[model samples]
Target: MEKKEAFLQQLSKENQKAQYHVMNLMESFRAINSTLELDEVLKKIMHFALNIVETAEAGYIQMYDESLNKLIIKTYVGFNENISHFKVNIGESITGKVFEDGCFRLITTRKEIYDSMSDLSKENFDFIDKAHHNNQKIKSILSVPVSFGAKRIGVMTFHCFDIEDGLSETDLLLLQSFASQAAIALHNAQLYTEVHKSLDEVTHLSQRLKETNALLEKRTYIHNHLTELSVQKKGLKAIIIEMNKLMDRNLVYADYLEGNYVPQHIKHFAKSLDDIFFLFTSKTKPAYVSICDTVQIDCYIYPIRSGSVLLGCLAVEGSSPLSQLDKLIIEQGAPILSLEIMKLRSQTEIMYKKTYETYHHFLKIKNPQQAEITAKELGIHHHYFLQTALIELDGNVDLHSLENDALLLLKHLKEKITLENSLLFSYNNKITLFSSARDAVSEAYITKIIESSIKWWNERFSVVARAGISTGHYYPGQAEENHLKAEKALLHLKKQKKKGILHYRDIGISRLFLQHPPEEINSFLRETFSLLWTGQEKKDDLLHTLFTYVQNNRSMTSTAKELHIHANTLYHRIKKIEDILDMDFSHFEDYLKVQLAVYLYKTFFGSLTKAGKLM
Candidate 1:
């Protein structure tokens, strides 16, 4: 009876211990499910698991990381913070094996856990072993898979310091039950986290959609504004003012063709506007926008162009970068601006043609009544002293280019002389300009004007040209006489072998040659140089030497210098001339006759032969 009682007492002690564990398990279930916090729930689960397995001193809950494909320690107790970040791959370590196999592992001895670790895990294990606090060491391990329904979520591991107190089968079973509850709580917490994240993402996307709609509306407004600006039928100033107001900036505009400024009420931005002009005229791009530096705030420049020709530019001063909409508006406005420039150009050209026709009529008419009518239409004062000039370009240039250059020169003349009563036209490869000054204007003043025009032509065309000015002051009806005199003066100036301005009065005795018939002049030249004209080659050399000799006042040395030949060569030529003519050098009569013949040949018949000797 005593043996049976002792056995019954021992069974009672075992039953009481089992009942205490059941109560602890119930308390753990309540504590772990108290909150939906995954981290807190996991911590409670680990604490309860270690409590139920009384001898275990350290533990950790490792959840499966789908992204890393590894088991990462989420909650831990009795381990250093660095160890809490430990990670294990599937089938790699004790916790990884339980997660991968979805089963419980009760390692009763240190050797069992160490033998199951891979070479990689052994290294990690050594690191974790050294990190144990208070000189404690891991002797046993019990790892159980934490699952929700059929899916395993993670592994809960418990570690002991003494082999004698290592985990038993009962401990593994109790921990597995705790893991089931932990898994459900962890899965619920995960779902809650993902739902909250999705809601935040939706909120962010909605805000972005609102912002994009507002931006689209703004873009539409700018497009409509630009379209309206493009359709307005008005002058360039009105258009540019509207553009300036739309852009909300200080705008300065120029029309290169008209030489007019927009906003006629504002002060001229002369210095600042130069940059815009230079860029527009120099650059070849059809449209361009660039940052420009100026006296005020820096600005953006948009060149106004049609095709390849630049009409002008619109300069806007502001403190912001030009947006795409701003650039588009400027580009669209360019055509409108170009149209205005072309219209102004056409009107000016028409006015110039009318004036040119009136002047032509004035030059052709003889009677005062007709001349007065044409002059009045041409806007020329009948009593003003009018002078005619003819400019002849000396080159083998293209006819079209020549005419264009001539027109440019005429424009420059009007600008330089600041004269409004000037008429210019191209006829017979010559640019003819008729300019009028007041009766009080001096001949010297008129000569200065002609000189300035010639100088301007030289600087612009980089070519040799000559201008002939009429000397006789005439009324409107006498334009024909003045124009004839200017032409005669130009012909005489060519024989002098000099370029630049020449006046009719300077021709002097050449006017007498002009009075005689061409046949009479030819006969005079032939009789004067009869002997030298016998042979073509010898005649050319002798006549040229004689002309140079006479031009230098019959001095042999000066003649040689002028001809760029040696004095001996000049002397030989002179001797040849004397022999050919059979005339004595000592006779003044013979020298006078030859010099007069040379002068007559040069004045009238120089253009007919190469050497200016009548054939």
Candidate 2:
């Protein structure tokens, strides 16, 4: 009966200890895996390992360092600093052998512990022995492999020094189970680290993608807005206004042909370019124009062109550099602006063609009633008397270039004529202006309009032109008559080979000569200016002298002064002229005949000079 009781007590004590160990191990596992840090995991594993097992007096945990091919002691309890420096190769010591074999080891005696070490590791053992210095002599040892799979991680070891039955099967099993948990904890830490790193990368990429998508959406919006503006048929002025609003900056469209800007308010940008018309046509790219001299500004210039033909340029002004989005705005806006310009130009050409037809039709209509109806149709009422001014470009200019100039001049003149109540049209090499003369004083106003336009056109557009105005205002019945007077004045001004405004009243009896046929004019010029017709070397000089003498009203002293020559020199020139003409200038009839011939020759402006022989 006593033996049975003792056996029952022993069995019950074992069950209680096993339950304690299992409960302690479960708690330790929860603590061990709480963090992902390798170093912290090692500390918790060592702490919980010692706490869970009663037999273990001192303990250590080692991790495999593949580079050193060694099991390095990482954490310990009841050991000196010398243990940290203690390293073991595979199968070198008890710890190494357990790691290498992936099995548990039981060193029940000190001799077994010494024999478990290889000869190569004797120095390491001696060093550890010396550190102990006979303090708490080591008796029994238990070592277990820390492994997750087939791969060995490290070794966990415990010792019971000089205690009979202090370590047992339960201790070995518990230690082995703890070693497995340590391996699992280490691996979980590594996996946790990798997951967090991957998450950070994904988050960064997502932010960048979001920003990129936003920028793309903004670009699409700007492009569509520009396209819609063009589709709506808004003109250049509307484009500039919207561009200024969109960019929140100053923008202007430069019209090279017109030598002006669309919005006259900001036309000062004209000076920003030295010459964008020629400069931008060739570049065909966006560039910076430094306008630092006057306003301390840096404007971005995007050249607007139609193939090789430079229409103009679009200018954005700012002291700061343009953003990529702003530059994109310019790029998209430029093409739409080009289309608008081309549309306006096409519309302008069609309108000019229609106006030219109207001009010719009204000038040719002779019936008063029909003229009045046509004039009313053209917004020319009966209350307004009309005067005409004719502009004839140089005969040698390119017809295409001249036509372009005439279109540009028409716009320029229309601006000047706005308040003056005048209208104008351009033909092949001519631009004609007609002003509504409310009274006699308005004729001079009409002359002033043509003169100012000619002066401005010649200066700005590099076009040379001569203009002639009518001598009288005409109602609708005499529209043809007024146009003739202006035409005759221009022809006479052309024969003078001058650049200025000439009124028909100022041109003398040259109008009478124009009434004759071209052949008659040619015949008359050939016979009268006969020396000039024969290609005499002094023909030009003689003709110039005779014309000057005629202009001086046939006064010998005044002619001498006007010719910048001595009276004797004038006499000799007159004598030479008389010799060439086979006539004397002393008789009034002879002087009168010579004067008429001279005037006729000076005022003949027709095809009679195609040969370039006669004056």
Candidate 3:
């Protein structure tokens, strides 16, 4: 009777435990479904799963991570370790196998079900083996996959005390109910997470839009300031021109050529156009007025007129200094600047038209041959001159100055050459005058003219100058040749060597020889006639002495005189020269050949020896 009573008590206790767990699960499902808050729902689901199931130390409501493609522990209760941070792939563990198979699993130990293997045989058996190694001996473990609608998100796991008999079908049914409730809670949490993320992105976009608008507003403000400055610059120019007129009227007579009109006021006022507007409006002003120390500004004011009917005053300004040049620009630009304001039929012409007319006239030349005829009319021959010289000025060749210079050179050359045959024309950017040898002046006479011309050119203007002359006969084509020679002579003057006048005929033998130096001849001789000297090797020495003798002029007497020896002593040197060169010294033809060879050797080789030493 006692044994039977103990068995009945154990059965009743198990039945009551099952009823109590079911009651709590119903209550949790009711509470979670009522509260739409994902956090509260998940908390209640975990409590029911852990307390009602009365399983192992831990229980969780988890979901699958779509991005990582793994199961992630979401919320848990009764877990002392960080199981929420742990991960398992979809088909890799006992829970993963349940999710993959779309069914629940109840295993006491892997050894019991090894022969009844399913498609999850590999990982399921591996987990059972791992559990055995961990001293979870023959323990009953339950896994139920959670689903929301058609999506299986995760699994709910329950581990029980290791017992010989594993969990029954009834145990799996309770865990499946828990997994279903857990799925609903996890779905709500993910939706809430996505909504919060979208709100944060919207907030960031709004801030960026505000920053872009602020930048555009700043740019608009700066543009307005620049527009204001342009208006003020025009107003300032008018004021400056009006002041200049006033100063000109009040102090022009007293100051004579100089004026007491201080440019400081004008400069400061121009600077203020860029500086003052920022105070009037709260916008930062742009740097509109650029003042350089090396530059000068000038202004003019004139009344706009339509056939003498005056309109408002107009102001003109420029960067050039307030000189006659700026005055000329105004005399040229002012009327054109007023043409639109003026009446169409007004008698007053446009300044640009007048400027064009003036330049057109200046560039126009009439009767170029008149200068040559003027010389001929002065009783000088106009053609077939033996020799001529050309003179040209240096630095800043202004047309008006060159014209005046040509006229002056023609007058001076007439006095020197005393011939009416020369020609003076502005050609090759210089004042070129052609004078025959009869009309050719001395270098001193030419030098005096150049000095005077330079002084004249520098009056009220400062520039250095050089002049050059050519040595050649004057003809129609000789103008170009003379000009080139003058330029070459000018280049020579830049070296500070010879100056005043130069003639091509006056170029010394040294310069002529330098033109075709001996090295070129040496190269030719080495290429063409090298055998003539290379055989005995004495040919070089004999040539050297022969050149030395001819340079002293084939005179045995003077050659000996310079060599500091008797005539017979020098003859001994000369007689050996003919033998080594294999040429006759006595025959006139051979003498001429030897003379040419010596002349060529001396001219091309510079010195018979490389330096001026005897070989």
Candidate 3 TM-score versus the reference: 0.36
Model 3, range 353-379, lDDT digits (tens) per residue?
343343223223234465345435433
Tens digits of per-residue lDDT, candidate 2, 100-145, equal: 8887888677766666664546668865665453566667888888
> Which lDDT value does model 3 have at 181?
75
Superposed model 2: Cα runs more than 4 Å off = 1-251, 255-294, 303-312, 319-333, 392-404, 418-422, 425-430, 471-473, 513-580, 587-593, 596-615
Q: State the C-alpha lDDT per candidate.
A: 0.71, 0.75, 0.51
Cα lDDT tens digits for candidate 1, 1-615: 999999999999999999998999999988888877777777788888888988888888888899999888898888887676577888887777777778788877666667777454665776677658865756888888989999988888888886744778889888878778788888988887788889999999999999878767766665566446556656667777766766645666765433456765124355445445545554755343444344344556667665645666676655477765566556656666777666765665576666666666778998888787877666566655767888877655565435434544565566655456656655434777776666646545756876887876665444467888885556758888888888887876665556788888888888877557778878888777777766677677677678778768889889898778899998888888888888766798888777787777766665325463544
Itemize residue pairs with steric clashes in candidate 3: 375-420, 376-420, 380-419, 380-420, 380-421, 381-421, 417-439, 518-604, 518-605
* Total colliding residue pairs, candidate 1: 0
Q: Name model 3 segments beyond 4 Å from true.
A: 1-15, 30-44, 76-86, 110-138, 160-170, 203-215, 226-615
Candidate 1 segments whose C-alpha is farther than 4 A from its true place = 1-232, 264-282, 286-310, 316-321, 390-447, 453-468, 484-551, 560-570, 576-615
lDDT of 2 at 69: 96
- lDDT at residue 425 of model 2 (Cα atoms): 75
